[model samples]
Target chain A: MFDIRSSIINQKKYKVFYAIIPFLALFIALFIGGVLIFFAGINPWKAYNYMLQSIFGNIRLFSEVFTHFVPLVFCALSFAVAYKGGFFNVGGEGQLYFGALTATLAGVYIQGLPAFIHIPLVLLTGFIGGAFWCWIAGILKIKLGADEILNTIMLSYLAILLINFVVMYFLKPANSYISQSEKIAKSAYFPKLIPHTQINLGVILSLLTVIIIYYFLYRSPYGYQIRAIGENSDAANYAGMNILKGTMTVIIISGGLAGLAGASMLMGTQYRLTPAFSPGYGFEGIGAAVMARNNPWGIILTAFLFALLRVGAGAMQRGVGVPLPISWTIEGIIMILITGSEYLSNKFSTNLIGGRA
Target chain B: MKKSKVFLRVFVLAFAILMIFSTLAMTAPLKIAIILPHAITSEGWTKSGFDGLMKAKEDFDIETSYQENVSEGELKGALRGYIAEGYDLIIVHEMGYNDPTLEVAEESPDTMFAITYGFKAADNVAVTSGTNWQANSLAGAVAGLMTKSNKVGFIISNDSPVAHNFLNAGFIYGAKRINPKAEVITTFVGSWSDVVKGKELAKAMIKQGVDVIYSQCGVVNRAVIEVCEEAGIWAIGAVEDMSYVAPQTVIANALAPTEYLVYGVIKEMVEGTLKGGRVVKGIKDGAEEITFNPLLKDKLPENGEEKIMKLRQEIVDGDITLEQMQEELNKQNIKF
Candidate 1:
């Protein structure tokens, strides 16, 4: 009994060490990025200074950062939820498109509804659209023995074409040159969080989602079942945890979260559905999930960091003369370092624990 | 006490000098920045814009910079970054940038924003597009006259019908004018970079007896032209002089003079003649031109170039209205 208790304590220490790896990895990535910038004959300090300013200098710029952040938070949580159950849900992009398209259709067609009813109804429609699309992949994977990864990726392209066709033929506004649906009713739009800024209720929704996801993943018994399946599905099945139910539930929830990102984007800022509006936000969410090491709180920080990089990259080009490609290079380096650190730390922890045992 | 008094006097002089110099800096040559969806090295819209910006920088003695491969989601942030960096003008080099450009323009009233291939403008933003129809009509006439099969193919990079209506309709009109029985088969590849798709579509159209292709894709146009080369058919270029890639297969280019448009706008900005509004430059403004490949100089059918040049003149003289072309598109029910 004492030995088992000691082993449990050691496992807690291992968890703490794993928690610090992401930050350490991030530090190394930034350091390498600084070195690359230095070799290019610019002051890395000036580059970072510009990024910091865009993120926190003024209320407006800060709000812009959040505008980028809101969609990303939803996407990361989408990927993270499925990831926790050992499912690679690569359908975030497709799910986001469906969500936004459905929300736009709801916002444009459904008239005379009150603001309270209309907004939630639009959001719920978006969630259903994304969930339904993802559910197709889930059903295929479960019933037909298809790979979810390949099915999800393929569905993303179909979703893009579907949205394009709908916008071009069905929802296109007359007298408008671009292929986009008409603007939603004012009542359907998310109320701005800060007057005169793009920051909207979507920001609050994302935050609430983060907390709710945390509780679902860590505090709930269902979360425990998911983790058990993730660690070892065969063992989990042997322990009588219904693997099939867990997989379907996590995938549906994951797709729904990503769909919410589409809602936040259309309702909060775009206010109209345009093809390519999601613009790879779903893929970027996967990057965020990887950077956060699949931790919900970590995803928030990583998503904000990506926003800062995006906004600051332009400034770096304008102010410091760093080419736009260099910014992407930095982003790639950072992600590689983060994932690499996570791998090495896990290996080291495992070896250390084995030796001590 | 004496040393402190001297230090105060020096500090005051320094502050006054700094204020005077900063004011001069603001009134100096305007700083310009451009954001593009693709690399400048690509032989298409981005290249022409980059070349124009460079020429304007030289002619006007202005400072300039650019960021490439900026997506729609990142556009607002890029514009804001340029504004925060004190750039006087920002040129968005794609149509997809219209909404983002306008959003940033409203937020930063002091910064002047210019967009190529956009139709909307504000007090602080200017939108401009090259005449897609003028040169395309001329090129289409050439294709119609040259085709032995009386069938021609049209491929575009999936711009909205509202945006490319003139080009699409004008091609049909110019072709049907010469050969009323000419069957114009149109296809949208949905992307500028999908070379494989472009090639496959061109092949399918060729199998359908399309002997000439009016290609409007970006990098993917090369694939279309290559397919033409293999099949020993003729192809027309869009926006850029693509004859350099395959002189044997390409006959004439329907030029959308993006460089001329961008250069004219930047020059106006330097001279303080630039204003916020839509400036739709077409054949009259020399915003559209076509270059015949010298390799195909001897292969011209009787009056092919003559007919195309005549139509070009008519377009420039305003004898042919965009409304007329749009009507043709409507009659054919061409989907955007």
Candidate 2:
């Protein structure tokens, strides 16, 4: 009993350490970024100062950041939920696209319904569409033992082609010059939360989603089962957990969350579905999930950081005259440093504990 | 106390080094930056823009610098960086930069900024665009006359007004003039560089009995030309004379000849003749034309060259306007 208590305490301590490590790594990345700025013949202090100003300076830019943040939060949450259940969902992009496609179809085809009914129906359709697509991969993994990673990636390509076909052949607008779906019904759109700035109810939905996900992952029976399976699949099975059912549930939920991200992007921002609709938010969510170590609150923080980078990078381009490709380089560097630091700290602590033992 | 002194000395040394570098950078002659929408290795579209900057550097004795593969989201930041660095002129090589360029122009009124494709005018911002629609219409006239199946296709990169006006309108109007019953089908591959998707779309159109294709996209058209050649269908190229890529099947090309436009703009900028407003270049200004593939010379219809020359003259004389083309099409009840 004493040994169990001590082991639990040790695990809790390690969890805290793991949580704090990424933030430290981020600071280190900023320092390296400063060096890069200096090498580029610009004052590092002014560059960083301008970056901050660009992020928080005006209502329009700040709102734009938050606008980008909403989808990221939802995508990160989706990844967090599945990650906690030990399922690696690489199909978030496909799921998001399908969600947008379904929401678009709902917005176009489903008419005569009241705003209250139409809006929610469209959002729900997005969730169901994404979940259904993900369930295909889940079913394959659980039933046929196919690799979820490969299956999900393949499905993403198919989903893109499928959306293109639908937009071109079936949902094509009257103009027919542009191969895109018709404009979504005005009633289907999410109302702007902040006027004049693209900030919509999607941000609120994303926040609520984070809270809900936190509760679902940490405070519920199903959540416990998920965590248990994540910790050790064999042990979870030994404890009378239904492995296939748990897998299916997590996969579907993960896909649904990603789909919600698509719904948020479509209804809140773009009013119509375009080919370049997603700026790779689904894949970016995976980065957030990894950086946050699969914690709901952590995912939120990391997602905001990424949003800052994206928005600030835009300002950086306009303000600093740095090429846009440099932003990708900066992001790639930051990710590498964070992941590398985590690896190093884990190894260091493991060695220390083993030595003490 | 000793450690503190050591730290202070090191800080002082670093400050001095930074100051020296800053002075050297500031005193440097001309700082010009170019932001391209696509990678240098991708194709000639962006490379042509960069080449213009390079030529300007040699002629005007200006420092030339560039960045490639810039997305819409990152364009503003790239512009800001160059402005902060005090670049004399910043050229953004893409149409999507219109909105971001407007914002940046307002922020840095002193910076002379130029963009291709889309037009958003400011005191310091200049918009340069090609007569792509006119050139496409010219190419369309040729495709309309030559196609064996009376069905032509267009591979659109994305759903933008500029792209829509050029390919769809031109094809429809031109097709109706030559072959009233001609059916024109268009497909958007959703990207300017998605060759695989472009090929697949062209193949699908071919399967639907489309015998001639006009690809308005830049690099993506490479696949369309390839697929058309393999399938023995005629294809129209965009920008440069891509007829050489697959000479046998590429019947003609809608040429932008960005090199001439870029050179002209840079020369005007140097001569202080570049006005800060929308500048529209067309066939009348020798900015765009249709280059017939030499390989297809024998296969051309007997009166093809003569008919095209007459239409060009009528267009230039304003006797046959683009609006008139649309009006004629409406009279025939033809839709793209």
Candidate 3:
């Protein structure tokens, strides 16, 4: 049981095992997905073909996939950062709604500024709004010893209601039939990267965020302390690392990342805030982060993979006869497999790396 | 090594087979795709849309498909997916799809887009509304005449001022026309499928002396009908002939001629007669009507069905106007 020397040596051998797990897990998930398609009375081969053709066959379709992928990357990284600091950050959805609401308000009323000045101002306001919403849970956890999970979950409900109220009464366009705010000012719009496609400046910003987060998490001293706190908060406290301050910093950064996702949708694609604008992207971000094992670089791959499945799902329905619910079923099965693999890897690693059985 | 070899072989084989099928799909007939915000299997609103699409598919001999449970966020992606697949006609079956439909229609001008309950239109977009207000007016008139309490209830799912304000105002107007002393009470459950809440709201209205309830509560309308049926209060149905849901309780059901409207649109498209603009079909155009439940016909007030039918025909003939109804409400100081 006291084999610290052997465990240290076994760490080198375990790197190869860790590297292969995600690919193996994804393959297993897709294989199960194939079985499900076969059971649905359609040839699994045809369905896969339809999905592939719809996603990659045309420039416009691929651009649409890219448009959806940008927000997922920001959202996944947000969750990944929070997870790195041992905070669950279940309030991402609420934070996202608040971000969108603030961004929409700023975009609608803040006028007569140049695009260079106006766009950043609106996005920064959105980030601040999201950070403030999550800061409530942070303060609650630190001061009252309240559960951040419950606080974040409840905050999400409040955020949704808040946005709905604002859109219904205040921001709503006069005489407009739908419950959506007026379009953002022209100066605040994210310039489209591709004509006639929704791909916009958010894609470039998301890439920059991924790189910055990677550098912050892996190459910075603060990042080391946060990782240490995540591993063992009591040990980190004994080492003179301020756990509470570290938690506060990471959760706020995580919230800001999710807020950027809201900005991406508001500026990049939607250009106005509408009801149900997120459609669970914030929650799905948690799924993407989990599949990536909270690695910033891995999040990019996983987010694109999820976007591929989503963009192809609609095509699967029209090109073939598979119901829309089956698309969600496929995603659910894959997420289950990824989580299962994560559990299995952790279980086997403790034994293989010279820990007590 | 052996497992890798087998996996590679299977992958290659699957890829080869997929290519063959992709080529075959390119040669299929003109495809039509409909995107629904709710599940297609639901018995009320989505079901009507599904029935209409199926009827169009059969009548025109064109290939039609639908993606259900789509959210507003996913609307643009779903529409573009259909457009990318070379679909000739795209049917967005919800009002929230308005802006997205317009955006996609502008991007792909050749593809014909039809939207239900949509207000705005573009060069290639056609907006069709069911105009269920006429049927609600008739149902309101019947409630006005039959209510002993002189107070009727209107329960709506959500409070979208534009989509519903007219129907609610119409109900009040119709009620006032027959019984000048009648009063209308309105309640919103804030959700479409909350049966418990619907029942609670309906019960409260019944206690307040609401003898009749005109419900636009979607699937949860059953809950309102259940409460009404138990308390011996009258109820009117919505969107379809929901009399079978509670045969003994429902007095009249508002029939939105969804199938006729959808099939008629498709027929026009095939005959090259469809154009882009707003197409509103009401009682006169046979797009909407009210059907009294035959089982409860005797329980209703004498000459009630006859008078409702006369009013319905008068609406069709433009004898009674929405303005006149609004004026009547104003005169009585009734707020819808």
Tens-place lDDT digits, model 2, residues B29-135: 66667788787555547766777777777888566667676654445546655665578778778765565577668877878887776556778878787755677
lDDT of 3 by residue, B74-147 (tens): 88888888887778888888887798789778878999999888889887998888765788888789889779
Q: Which stretches of model 1 miss by more than 4 angstroms? A: A1-16, A35-45, A232-243, A355-357, B328-336
Candidate numbers, best DockQ first, in rank order: 3, 1, 2
Question: Model 2 lDDT vs. the true structure?
Answer: 0.77
Model 1 interface CAPRI class: medium
* DockQ value for model 3: 0.58
- Predicted structure with the largest DockQ when compared to the true one: 3
* Candidate whose lDDT is highest: 1
| lDDT (tens digit, per residue) of candidate 2 on A1-357 | 986677667767776777677777777777877777778877777877887886676665677677568888888877788878888888888898899899888988887788789888998999998898888988888889899889887887788777766776677665454455666788888888776565788888888888988998899999899889988999999999988788788998899988888887878766666554577888888888888878888887899999888876666655664555666677777789778877887786676455232
* Chain B TM-score, candidates in order: 0.92, 0.87, 0.88
Q: Please give the distance, in angstroms, between residue A345's alpha carbon in candidate 3 and its true position after superposition.
A: 2.2
The reply for model 3, stretches above 4 Å from the true place, is A1-13, B1-29, B203-209, B230-232
> Which ten contiguous residues of candidate 3 chain B have the minimum total lDDT?
B157-166
Estimated TM-score per prediction? 0.93, 0.70, 0.91
Q: Determine the backbone clash count of candidate 3.
A: 0
- lDDT per residue (tens digit) for residues A1-357 in model 3: 567777765675577777777777667766777788789898878998988887788888888777678889988998899889988898788898988988888898999889989989989988888888888988898899899999998999899877877787888878887888988999999988877777788888998999999999899999988988888999999999999899999989988888888987898888889767888888888888898889998899889988888887877877887777778887887788788877887788776864442
